[model samples]
Target: MHTVDHLETLCARAWPALAEVPLGNWWMRAAEGFTGRANSTLTCGDPGMPIPDALKLVQRFARDHGIKPTAHVVNGSPAESGVEAAGWRVDLDHPGGAESLVMTGPLEKFADGVVESRDLPGWWELTAGSEITTAQRHVLGSGPNVCFASIVVDGVVVAAVRGAVVEDVLHVARLAVRPSHRRQGLARRLMGELAGWGLTQGATTCVLQVAEHNEAAIRLYEELGCTEHHRYRYWIPAVS
Candidate 1:
């Protein structure tokens, strides 16, 4: 199997969607339109049936959920061409609508401080602040093995990141820094804490997804010794 396929498979398991249904070998995910990752079909391996059948299943699932059907296709995968042939165009309105790079690196690179685990309330307050919606809470708390890592300045949480370990790979997400706390290496510090925690759970590598157009984040990941492992884009049904 390709490295991207492996990484993507691990990612799907690590960051599970709110609801999932099997369409042959594909996974149809829905999360009340929270984000593309949760709302789109995950075309990881062979869809197990004809392209038309798969598309129809996607449509039915979306209709049942009252969401516009979308497919998450890996770049250069056979499913990508199949979906495009079925009149599924890229979802331009979605964040990172074009393509997103999957980055990976050794967990040791960021394995530094001791990572502290927090309950939902503490994690939400530190990372998302107040006024978070129900969907966001569901997504953030979906993972079975998720940990929220933070770096405290004085006594306040200034930098935070989320990590989930699946199949021995650490899937990092939601790395954030307070506006007044940027450019002080807090992001890196958060990564170190999370990675260190992951290592204790038998994780050897780390992976994360970032939009291709996010140069700043891309640069930061690269600086942390992360490299592109794969790319993927979302496909929405073309309107007649």
Candidate 2:
């Protein structure tokens, strides 16, 4: 079993940010406000200083990048306590959720399909609302060993997912199925395709992050034998 910290480190590489700065053992990441995971300080390990002092640096980094002063902390961890004691509060307004869980399981190989080095227009059409932002492209395209998998039907993409292999882990994200294509197991197919692709790359396990409130997605992952590895929440300076 991989420790929480080890798993987090792998995921960090799987979905890289445009900028990653180390604050002692902590990681401060920024990607032009694209996603919280990429745009917040990750309070994982010791920072070689008091928590309050570390938080000051975190806020300063946020201000320098024009993003929220946020920290991604594992729930119930010492870092979480320190951040809270320093007047940081859980971010209930985060678009993803107040809390998120990491799920992992052994990779199950399925069938092979076309994989892309760069996201296609259909992927952007399915995942984003408007023109793809540079920050989004940076984060998505920045993964060290990443692949874009999708299922095309009638010359249109109805489902898509991203997979990145970091060490022996396959980190999956950007799962989406067109509303009209739901209930047809396209999501599973895409996952299986990614699994096949990952296995070829020597990945033995799969990991993904999901919001705690997303029961449906959790159920799908559970069916694929994934279990909760850890839960984390985004924190920000208290609204005082």
Best by lDDT: 2
TM-score of each: 0.93, 0.95
lDDT digits (tens) for residues 1-240 of candidate 2: 888888888999887888899999899999998889999888888999999999999999988888888999998888988999999999999999989999998876343463554467988778664588888887887677888788889988889888899999999998999999999999987887788888889989999999999999999998888899999999999963
Instruction: Give the candidate number with the greatest TM-score.
Output: 2
C-alpha root-mean-square deviation, candidate 1 = 1.9
The CA root-mean-square deviation of candidate 2, after full C-alpha superposition on the true structure, stands at 1.7
State the C-alpha lDDT per candidate.
0.82, 0.87
Q: How accurate is candidate 2 locally (lDDT)?
A: 0.87
Residue 46 CA error for candidate 1 (Å)? Answer: 1.8
* Model 1 Cα lDDT, one tens digit per residue, 1-240: 237667787788776777889777788988788778878898977888989789988999999987879899998998988899988898877865568999999988868876987654545776666877776777777675888787777777777788898878999888888889899888877788888899998888989999988898999899889999888998888983
Which residue pairs does candidate 1 place in steric collision? none
